[model samples]
Target: MKALVELANKAREVSGVRIYKRNVEAVLSAVLKSGDFWEIVDMSSLPVPAASGIVKVLIDEGILFIDDEENIKLTQKGFDFVRELGIETFEDHSCKACEGRGIPFYANIELYREFLQLTKDRPKAIRDYDQGSVTPETTISRVLFMDSRGDLRNKDIIVLGAEDDLTGLAIALTRKAKSVLVIDIDKRLIDFDNQIFKELGIDNARAMVWDLRNPLPEDILGNFDVFVSDPPETLPAFRAFIGRGIATLREEGGVGYFGLTLRDSSVFRWRDFQISLTSEFGVAITDIVQNFNHYITWDYHSETKAAELAPVKREPKTIWYKSAWYRIEALPGFKRWNEPISDDVFYLDEEGSTT
Candidate 1:
């Protein structure tokens, strides 16, 4: 038991990624519950790399071992360690039907099919922009959910930060919103979205390129009823995407939809961000749905740190990356900052593995 705590402390000191004692406890509990490598990571908030690093640490120290089937299993020392830690069993607490997403994946079944077909030839996600698109189900569900919350219908919406998921296209297809304006740094995505708008005669929607790292254009300030984005989680990225989103709102009661992932963020980081938003921006967090956004594994995943560091060394057979959906509303007297965001680590953080 003392050794396990010491190992976690050492990992915190040495691993480039954040490693709390809870991370060690989570991996150990996940191992007890499932032998499959992915199941172990999925059972926790950890990204694949973070989970793998903990498992590898334990394996090297003889607390865990790979079984004959190439599955991860605890050794005698591992069993003893878990017993001493008083974690005799592990149980998954997420909703079984929605897979803990808090909403049915097929909430908007018809739109999903159309959006899927509409985006079949869309631009591939490029690392130059740190792009990774969400599943079609997620995109439609997000729009529908916003409408349910009275934020979508007839509202002029701006999709800033990143449009790689084609959320702007999905929003335009609904014809529920008055207008959709998409702004991103990636020209290919902007071109792809504009072409879709033209072919379908979607006069209500338009896409353009604008790097979010700089201040937004003066002409576009305070020009929308709502905003949506799936942005990078670094503090500066949050300011660029979320701060700018709040500023775009023409008046109070305007809503914003965005996704945040645990893969690149820890609870401590999340707490700091929440404090910043509520205290400085004067917004209310109306909703947070866990694992609501599922990312279809990208083509370049095998070359990423997650793949290289995984102890099992196998390809993912199913969707693995996910994010939480957050809905924020601009309350009366809400504050907004339109200044440029400057941070060298805007795209990557110590807890980050996917970017």
Candidate 2:
């Protein structure tokens, strides 16, 4: 039942709806008490699109049904599933750490705080808009999330791109990992990360300048246990970054973490990427955490001429963009060792040209 609830929660997250677990539980409870399994409930009654996604998952698992009227009905299997869940008497409990906010509390808060302080003076985003950095807290959360997945300790981790130094530094400061490597196209970011490591007396992490357009360096190929990236939202860029990340893995049992947002990439694009990863690259997506990143926006277009400006009323001041974090694993027996590299440009402006 817990596993099912978790899956339902993920489904909700993937639906791009900001909803709480308690609300999802409410929807399930309502469905169960509506008296008849054959009766249709209004889809609009669900708190978010994730409820709709859960229904779809249930239907796919042979536990629910969608009738001709587009109404949701329960199958016999669904009844048994629900009965096992004991939904009627189920009680939703809030997380004590995040106060039901879903953010996990770190065991060593002081260390995390220190790490944030160290990275406070990191470089700002370039004029190219090549990088939109997230808060230091968010990066630490990512490290903790990865640790929770049992992917961090004694592992050789690599960051495919390191626009934000907080992530690599957090991993290194923990001193649990064997080593940390950060590769980026931006020389300034690479230099900054290395400088942070040097100043802090951290020995396990190192940064290098490497563009994703070319193949990974031979020395590092198939050397890492895990790869982390926040690639551009475009398909070509995603393919290039993820493909390169996969290529850097140890052929079997290697994992990759990345961030994708619905703001730029749609659900359909996500589905296509998943298929490509699983079918073409032999990488299977294991988990996706929604709203994992809260990026702080900065103005990079102030220098643009008025003739090139879009008809916006004012600059956006609120932090609205969020990313869905993905965890993918390399399967055994097959590998894409000889995949051809493309020379396509990935970072384009809204008008579809390089910024």
Candidate 2 clash pair list = 12-50
State the displacement of the C-alpha of residue 167, model 2, in Å, after optimal TM-score superposition.
Answer: 1.4
The Cα error of candidate 1 at residue 19, in Å, is 3.4
Q: What is the lDDT of candidate 1?
A: 0.82
lDDT, candidate 1, 1-355, per-residue tens? 4565677766565455667788888888888987777667767778655787788788877888998777899989889888988875568678777667666657777888888888889888777777888887778778878778887788999999668888898989888889999999999989998998899999999999999989988877888899998888788888889999999989888888899988777777788878877999989998888888888888877767666667876667777688899999889998877998776888877676676
TM-score for candidate 2, residues paired by index: 0.67
CA lDDT, every model vs. true structure: 0.82, 0.65
Number of the top candidate by TM-score? 1
**In candidate 2, what are the lDDT values of residues 1-355, reduced to their tens digit?**
3456565566655555444455445556656644222111121123223344555555666766756644455688777776776766323364556423255636668767887677677778765535778766677777887888888999999998755535776788888899999888888778888998898788889988887767677888889999899887677777778888888898688999998765444455677888888988888889887666766754553443211321222333445445678899999953544244565557642312112
lDDT of 2 at 196: 80
Which pairs of residues have clashing backbones in candidate 1?
none
For residue 204, model 2's alpha carbon misses the true position, in angstroms, by 1.9
RMSD of each: 2.2, 11.9
Best by lDDT: 1
